[model samples]
Target: MRATVIRAPHDIRVEEVADAVVREPADAVVRVLRACICGSDLWAYRGESARQPGQRIGHEFLGVVEGTGADVTGFAPGDLVVAPFVWSDGTCEYCAEGLQTSCPRGGFWGSAGSDGGQGEAVRVPFADGTLVKLPADAASDDRLLTGLLALSDVLGTGHHAAVGAGVAPGSTVAVVGDGAVGLCGVLAARRLGADRIIALGRHTARTDIARLFGATDVVAARGEEAVAAVREMTGGHGAQAVIEAVGTEQSMRTAVGIARDGGAIGYVGVPHGSGTGLDLSVMFDRNIALRGGVAPVRAYIPELLPDVLDGTIDPSPVFDLAVPLGGVPGGYKAMDERTALKVLVTP
Candidate 1:
């Protein structure tokens, strides 16, 4: 068996590794049919953070069940499933409350778990709780791989932002970035009935997709300028809802500044591990409710799964490159260089 490993920053390698086996009664092993490079993966790749050498390096994936524990009743051998980035016990208090990302005992795949997501077959604990069953047909079909793979992360995260932001029909919304997640946010907003979608993006191609995903407008601005533009678009009233997709100081500021005084700001960026200098005085003055962070992906996956199956949402457009697992290094380079909005890896 082989897996993608990042031994160090900018040091990704594909090496043959030991095969995975079930370690618990709730565990299962998945033969990955498809996996993807996530935006958070880039944080470790570009030296922003440290990734254990050879740590399994992927989390968003879809696969066929190769084996399952005796107690697992919801899945079987050869069943296709979507594995959320975080594995959780669905019965946990948090999971029960629709916040699986915060499950007390949940383990994130690309971090403290057995390994990363970029591999041929991987050990998956809590199989019944973590993997979402997809239509049997999609398991063997490569065409459905792209969209099916998205249920694990970006698409789910995007849906989280929209739901959290309360995007209403005929409402004006502002999306704070143009990355895959940001574009997906635009798509999610449209699905929620937001009418005027303003995407703040500088890249022509990314912004174009934002429009395709349902953004009614685009702005090539940054920092305060971008916030100003979003306000101007709303006739100085600011957007009724704002999706902060970029986890940066500037992105957060822009999201806060461009939202209507009483509007909600739903953010799902990875926080880039930076402190936000939020002005409490202003936030209080505006009566704005600012909330958003790590999306409880598992909570949204089930809801968004049908849309992808019925062809109602084409989230796959975010993939600018799809590479084999062995070429995982290129996935890092492509995203780091801004050559790709999102990269998908086939294992």
Candidate 2:
């Protein structure tokens, strides 16, 4: 089998690796059908996130069950399923509370000694808990499969941002960033019934998708200028709910600046750099609430899967580029160069 491996900064390759197989009673081997690159993966690609010379990469995928260990009963061969970026034991207290990311035995894919999603197949641990069964018909529908693939990460993360920010009927929401997750945040705010969605981004193509996803307004500015635009649009009140999907000091500050007094900010962008630029004094004085972190996407899958299947929300548009397993290096380059929003990998 061949899988993507990070040789160094700006060096991603598809190399032959050991085959995936069930290694534990709670394990399952899945032949990947659809996989995609994540924005977070760029950290390693850019050398911002450390990785060994040959570490596996990628973390979103859906596939058909090739085999399952004896103790795994929730899935069987030929079942279509999606695996969350992180695997968790469904029985953990954290999982029961819908925080599978904190499960005691949970682990992320592509970590050392683990198989990555950007491969032909993967050996999944805690199979029943980590894999969500998809409708058999989804396997034959490319569009539906792409939408289902978003549930493995971005869609669920965006939904988490909405839920964390308390988006509700008629609420005014602002989404920071215009990347795939940010665009998905716009869709999520719409799904939650937000009447006004303000998307902050500079990219024309991405903002166009934001509009299609229900962004009532697009602020193409950045820094305090963007904050002023959002505030003015809201009559100096700012948005009631803000989804901070870009993990950066400036973006975080923009989220805080554009949130109405007593409003909430749901931040799901994987924090990078030295400081978060969070000011406790301002939040305290304004009674603003801060929520969200690494999204527990595994928990949100069940809630959002129905909408994807029914075509109520289509996240597939975020996948602007498609690549075969052999073209993964170019896929990474395209994303790194900002030429692609998201890359769909067909193995």
Residue lDDT tens for model 1, 92-119:
8998988888888788886844767898
Per-model TM-score, in order, reads 0.97, 0.99
What is the lDDT, from 0 to 100, of the residue 214 in candidate 1? Answer: 94
For model 1, the stretches where C-alpha displacement exceeds 4 angstroms are: none
Q: In candidate 1, residue 41 scores what lDDT?
A: 86
Residue 40 in candidate 2, Cα distance off native in Å:
0.1
True-vs-predicted CA distance for residue 343, candidate 2, Å = 0.5
- Which lDDT tens digits does candidate 2 get at residues 1-347? 99999999999999999999999999999999999999999999999999999989999999999999999999999999999989999998999999999999999899989999999999999998899999999899999999999999999999999999999999999999899999999999999999999999899999999999999999999999999999999999999999999899889999999999999999999999998868889989998898998889999999999999999999999999999999999999999999999999999
Largest lDDT belongs to which candidate?
A: 2
Model 2 clashing residue pairs (backbone): none
Q: Return the clash pairs for model 1, or none.
A: 7-53, 56-116, 57-116, 58-117
